[model samples]
Target: MKSVKGHLRNRLVKARKKSAGQANIWLFYSFKLDADVPIIGDLEMLYWVSELETQPQVRRFTMEHEVEISLEELGDSFEEITVTRVEHIDGSIEFHQVASKQHDSFEKVSVPVRYKIENRIEKSHLVVIPAARLKAFSKSSLSFWLKVIAFVSQVRGYDLRYEMGQVGTSISICGDGTIETLLESLSITDPALAVGAVCRSVLQGNIIVDGLRSFGRNTRWRTP
Candidate 1:
């Protein structure tokens, strides 16, 4: 496979010529850069990053890996870690060696990303997905979040976003409350379903969540 930079650059150069989905560019706002960054990834990653930006606890995000790797050494498919941020509330930006996902999904306890350039291996301090509050990064937690992120970001994304468009207007008018309470007022009974809707709104930049820590029914939220 071609290098990440090379592939993206080539795609960008011929962007206008490429048909439909091939040329679709995603612009994501980065708190760290204080500007919109061009995002390239699948819908799951796009949704994950978007959700992170809305949470109060999240300070910023940084790409973990965007470098060349040796296909001969690492094979056709290696871990292509993108943006990652430490979970600690330091008010300081830092990325470090994080453990590889035993299950998939990052919450804490980071591991290093290894890549090859010109047949030389290099290490990058890109934290994998990290949840707030330092811990060993549970397998179960990772699996759950990974499943949720994957599903909401990919599988049911379209339907959810369409629903969120309507839900967001109601949420903005409904006033402030935890995700649970607000959805309850709207007669949305399922907490999981409610969280997904609110989260979709958050991604759409219509509504806002008060916190990113342990996002659930009790998570505080508001409209912007």
Candidate 2:
């Protein structure tokens, strides 16, 4: 009986290897905001906290080498944040909050809110990337470049920069404006060309229609 079991296990493993072939690699990009960023309106806050998922897929590719190649090409132009907690509430005026601490900061604070979709809003612009994407780019140089572009796209509302290294990618979000200012900055001088460019870029990344941002570790929160 033991011998038969061992044989079956071996056969199963071989079958899986044959059928599964290679894993489809993907990167999960996420952004975590401070719950108090004020720019996020009620509707946008709800969607960000309640409706939107914490994880966003910035890009995907089959070959690990290709991913590394992309990251290298981009280099020092992406960002990453880990969110500790997020919440939403319904009342006369709906609101949401997110609390977190980044490596660069000594303490956590509530970020101003900004209107997103509907009455929902985002306390802060948070983005996440999945483990799959990491594996794809594990041995490539281009992974860093790809990450930079994806990070920039995700936090279009912020003044952000990407830092690249052989070790990994880093993103920095700058806070230097009000919600109105942020929105104004995003105003496309050429809407048609801007829209076309965004569409094309998104397609290149193979991002899903319902792609959402994922929160990260070290997140903390309070509800009222």
Model 1 misplaced regions, further than 4 Å: 1-158, 187-194
> Which candidate leads in TM-score?
1
Q: What is the C-alpha RMSD of each candidate to the true structure, in Å?
A: 13.5, 22.5
* Candidate 2 structure quality by residue, lDDT tens digits, 1-224: 55522322232211111122243323333233312232122222222322232223222111101000011122332222212233322211112212211133322222222323345333232222223333332334233233333443454454222111100111013223222232233434543333333322323332222222221111111111
- The TM-score of predicted model 2 comes to 0.17
- Give TM-scores for every candidate, taking all chains together and pairing residue i with residue i: 0.35, 0.17
lDDT per residue (tens digit) for residues 98-205 in model 1: 222243433443334455446666654333333322233232233333333433444242355455655766776776777667666654555556556665565444
The candidate that achieves the highest lDDT relative to the unseen native structure = 1
lDDT (0-100) at residue 79 of candidate 1?
A: 40
- Show model 2 residue runs off by greater than 4 Å: 1-54, 57-136, 140-155, 158-206, 209-224
